[model samples]
Target: MSEINLTIDGRQVKAEPGMTVLEVARREGIDIPTLCHHEKLEAFGGCRLCMVEVESRGRTSYAVSCLYPVAPDIAVRTRSEKVDKIRKLLVEELMAHAPDAPELVTLAREYGADRNRFAREASFCVLCGLCVRYCDEVKKKNAVSFFDNGAVRQIKFVPEVAKNECWNCQECFAICPTSYAQAAYLLTEALAFPGQHQSVKRATKAAARKRVVIPIAPVPMTA
Candidate 1:
C-alpha cells in the first residue's frame, strides 16, 4: 500500500493508505481515546470517544477516528475544546451501562463525566461486542451473538453449541470488557447439567489451556 502524509495534532504523520486516523495517531504516539477499537478485532466504532476533527480541502468536520481513514493533506486534531466535550459526553453515556466497570469509572473521573447523572441499571455486560467479535473472528465458534434490538438488545448464547464447546474454551471471557461470561457460563452449566453448576468453575479452570489477561491503561473506557 502507498503511504500518505497527514498532520495529526500539528505533527506530520506518514501512514499507509488504509490506516485510520486513530491508527496514525497511535503510531505517532498521540493519545486518542477509544473504547470499541481492539487491535485484535475489527473496529466497531460503537463508542464515539475517538472522535477527531479532520480538515480536508479547507472544510473541517468531526469523524470517528477508528472509521475515518488517513488521506493526503488532511489535518487531524485529536484533542480540542470541542473534542473534549464530545468525549466527556460519550463517557457519561457509557457510565449508564457500565457504572461499576473499572475502566469506565477511571475514564469518567478523568473526563469529569458524572456516573450518577443518569439512572443506574444493574448489568455487567456493556454490549461492546468484544466478546461477540472474539468468538466469531478469533475463536471461529459462531456460537454467540447480540440478540434483540435497541433497549432490549443483549448477547444471545446458542446453548446447544455453547454447552458442548465453550466450557473448555472460554477464551472470549478474557477479552470481555467486563467478565459477564463468568456469570453467563455458570448459568449455561446449570442448564446443561442440573446438579453440576457448582463445579463449573473448577472444571473450566482445570481444562483451560490459554488464559488471556487484557491490560487496561488510563485511556478510554476500554483502557
Candidate 2:
C-alpha cells in the first residue's frame, strides 16, 4: 500500500490512501471523539463529535475525521478553539436526545457541556445509526431501520419478521447508546402477537426494493 504524508495537530504522520483522518489520528496517538464509529463495522459518520480542522490546498475547514480521508499535503488540528467549540455543541445536542447514554454523558463532562442546555422531550435514540448499521452490515439482517427522514425519523421494526427472521437477536440492543427498553417492548409485542405488526409489509417492500440507504458522511466546512 502506498503512503501519504500529513500533519495532525503539528505532528507529521504517514497514512494509507483509504485511511480516514480519524484512523490516522488514532494511529498517531491523537484523540478524536466519536459515537457511531466501530472498529469491526463500516464507517458511519453520523455523529459530528469528531470534527477536526483540516487545511488542504489552501482551504481550511472542519471535517468529521472518522469519514474524512487523508491526502497528501493535508494538515489537521484535532483540538483547537474552533474545533472544541464545534465538538461541544455536537455533544450538547446528543445529550438532549440521549441524556442517559453513558458514553454521551462522559463526553459531555469532558467538554463541559450542560445536559439541559438543549433538553426537550427525552429522545432515547440519538440517531447514531449504530444498531441499524450493525443489523444491516454485520448480522446481514434487517430487523430495524430508520423510518422516514429529518426530525420525524424513527427506528422501525417489523414485528413478524423480527420474530422469525431476527431470531431474537439483541446484538443491536446491547450496543445501543440508549436504553433498550423500547426495543425490548417491540420484541415482546412480536412474541405475543406472532404476526401482528405494522411494519411487516414495509419490511417486505423494503427488502424487495433493496433501497440502498447510504450512510451520511460529514462534509468539510467551507472557508
Candidate 3:
C-alpha cells in the first residue's frame, strides 16, 4: 500500500493510502470524539461528532472524519471553534432525550454543553443503526429493522410480532453501543423475577470467568 502524507492538527503525518481521517488522527495521538463508531464495526459515519475541517488542494470544508479518506497534502483540523460548537449542539440534543446515558452525558460535558434546550422526549434508541447494520451486514440475520418514519421512527425488532424476532443470540443487545442492553436486562429481571432472585456469582464461578461481584441484599428468613 502506498503512503500518503497529511497534516492533522497542524502536525505532519504519514498514513497509508485510503486511510480515513479518523485513522490518521488516532495514529498521530490526536483524539477525535465519536459515537456510533466502534473499532469492531465498519465506518457508518452516522454520528457527526467526528466532523473535521479538511482542506485539500484549493477546497476546504467540514467532513465526517470517519468516512473521509486521507489523501496527500490534506490538511485536517480535528477541533475547530465551528466544529466544537456544532458537536456541542449535537450532544445537547442527544442528551435531552437520553439524560441518564452516562456516555452521552460525558461527551456533552467534555464539549462544555451544560443544557439541552430541546423539550424532553421519550427515546431510548440513539438511531445509530448499529443493530440493524450488524444484523444485515455482519451477521446476515436481517430479522430486525427501523420502521415508521420521522419522529415516530424507532428500532423495530419485528413488525408483526411485538416480541423481538431476534435469533435469541442477543447480538442486537450486545452490539448496541449505548447501555441499552444493560438497562433492558435490569428491567427484565425486575419484572420477570419479581421477588425471585438469581445471582451472577453462580454463573461466573461455574464458567470460570472473571468473578462479577455484585452486591445482593441478604434475604430475610420467612416467619
Candidate 4:
C-alpha cells in the first residue's frame, strides 16, 4: 500500500493507505483510548470514546479515530479541550452501564468523569460489540450476537451454538471491555439450559464408570 501523510497531534506522520487515524496515532505512540475498536475486528464505532478533532480544508470537526481513515494532508488532534470534554461525557455515559469496569474506572479518573452522572444501569455492558465482532470475525464462531435494539439492546449467546462452542472457546471474554460477556453467557446458560451442568456431570460419571474395572485381584487369589 502507498504511504499516506497526515499530521497527528501537531506531529507530521506517515501511514499506509487504508489505515485509520487511530492506527497512525497508536503507531506514533499517541495514546487514544478506545472501547470497541480491536485490531482483529472491523471498526464498529459503537463507543465514541476515541473521538478526535480532525482538521481538513481548514475546518475542524469531530470523528471517531478508529473509523476515520487517515487522509493525506489531514491534521488530527488526538486531544483538545473539546475532545477531552466529549470523552469525559462519553466516559460518564458508559460508566452508567458498567460502573465497576476497571478500564472505565481508570478512564473516569483520567477524564474526571462522574460515575453517577447518569442513573445507574446495571446491565454492565457498554455495547462495544468487541465480543460479538471478535467471536464472528476472528473466531468465525457466530455463537454470540446482539439482541434487541436501542436502549434495551443486549448481547446474547445463541443457545445451541453457545452450549457446544462457548465452553471450548471463551476468546470473546478476552476482548470484552466491560468483562460482562462471560457473565452474560453464564446467565444465558443458566436460563436457557438449566440442566447443562448436570448433563456434563452425568457424562463425566458415565465415562469414569467405563474405566472402573474392579481390579483383577481374583486371579491372584486363585493362584
Best by lDDT: 4
Write the residue-wise lDDT of candidate 2 on 187-206 in tens digits. Answer: 34433454656644443343
User: What does candidate 3's lDDT look like per residue over 1-223, in tens digits?
Assistant: 7788889989999998878999888877899988777776789888788999999888989999999999889899888898899899888877665655667778877898865577765455566777767767776766456666555655544322213334255676766656443333333333333454442333334222211122221222221
What candidate 1 gets wrong by more than 4 Å, as runs, is 149-151, 197-223
lDDT of 1 by residue, 53-146 (tens): 9999999999999999889999999888888888888887777766766777788888889988877655556778877888888888866777
Please give the lDDT score at residue 134 for candidate 3: 74
Model 3 alpha-carbon drift over 4 Å, by segment: 159-168, 181-223
**Cα lDDT over the full model 2:** 0.72
lDDT of 1 at 199: 61
Clashing residue pairs in candidate 4 are none
Q: Number of backbone collisions per candidate, in order?
A: 0, 0, 0, 0
The candidate that wins on TM-score is: 4
Model 3 residue 221 CA deviation (Å) reads: 40
C-alpha lDDT values of all predictions: 0.73, 0.72, 0.66, 0.79
Worst 10 residues of 2 by lDDT: 214-223
TM-score of 4: 0.85
Cα displacement (angstroms), candidate 2, residue 130, comes to 0.8
Each candidate structure's TM-score, on Cα atoms with residue i matched to residue i, is: 0.83, 0.79, 0.73, 0.85
Name the better of 1 and 4 by lDDT: 4
